[model samples]
Target: MPVREMKIDDLPQVLQIQKALAFQDWNERQFIAEITANYALCVVYVAAALHTPILGYAIFHLMGPDSELLSIATNDSHQRAGIGTALLNAGIAHLDFENGDKIFLEVREGNTKARRFYEKHGFEPYAERKKYYADGENAILYVKAT
Candidate 1:
């Protein structure tokens, strides 16, 4: 998989893959619109396979001096194959963290698998917010210091 910053033209494909992997039903249009409108603050990655069009993507937002991971997902057909990790590495690489600080992100507390994935990448839970999701799930805040 070749990971790089996503072009505006890639939004549709990225949103489609993300919505399909979402555990809870949600509107992907909002995500697409936000990333499109906020490209200056967003960094996304697309994973292309040997014979496939695109397998998955990851998006992150840069706010002030901090980088926040917005979302990350792999196509169902490509899950557990390291595409997600590749996307994450690519997203982090795009950040202008010359100060060598930490990156942040929030994930559903019930998403044990995703939590473990972040932990494997050096993200540590530092806080939590209640009812952060449309489904009323709590969001666990994780940070990784580079």
Candidate 2:
């Protein structure tokens, strides 16, 4: 798992991974906003042997002591291969360095795999928002201390 701070040049590959696995479809503009935002920490997991193509990415927004895991996804071909976990660990390390107190995230109810993954990683689900998604899917909100 070779991880690094996401650079602007990585958006094309990141966007491709996002398109294949993201819960919320984010355009290039949104990705740019995160890359340029001072409060956001975006990290990418690259395959060193494959010319460093992005295998996954994680976006974390740090607001003082509070933070949010905005999005995280691994390319479909690389799913369940620890790419997601590597991205998550990288994001958590960055958040810790920034003195973040907690990390929050919301996952679609139907995304059981994601929900399970979060829970497995120590995130505790505290609430659920009905019809939180545009598709009327409920979103389970979870939080974990950094």
Candidate 3:
């Protein structure tokens, strides 16, 4: 897999992946804004073979010494193949290299798999937001010191 900065042309494939996943999906404009933002870091993981699909993407924002992982997702077909992990590790390393002091993200309270994945990467639960999702699910904030 080759992880690289997301390009404008990649939005359609990215949107398809987002639509297939059961999560808070961002609209095309939102993705465009993030990709163009001065403080944002957006990356995509592309499959190695010719004409292969994009496997995953990660979008984060860095402000001062704090970084927030806004979204990350792997295509359903590519899940559990380390694509998400690679994107996350690459994002964290990018943040650290940029002198970030801490990184934050929020996962749905019921997403045990995501929570466990963050925990495995040394993120600790810092807070919770009630009814953070449109579906009335709470959001668990997780933070990792860089």
Backbone clashes in model 1, listed as residue pairs:
none
lDDT of 2 by residue, 1-146 (tens): 49999999998898887776656788999999999999999999888778647888899998767789998888888888888898898888777644338889999989988888898899999999999888888999999875
The TM-score that candidate 3 achieves is 0.92
Tens-digit per-residue lDDT, 13-87, candidate 3: 999889998676689999999999999999999986846568899999977687899899998887888988999
TM-score per prediction, in order, is 0.79, 0.92, 0.92
Q: How accurate is candidate 2 locally (lDDT)?
A: 0.86
lDDT of 1 by residue, 44-130 (tens): 444344444567666677665677887777778877888778888877766757676778999999998889899999999999999
Cα deviation at 31, candidate 2, in Å, is 0.4
Q: Which ten residues in a row have the lowest lDDT in candidate 3?
A: 91-100
Which consecutive 10 residues in model 1 have the weakest lDDT in total? 40-49
Instruction: Give the range of the ten consecutive residues with the poorest summed lDDT in model 2.
Output: 92-101
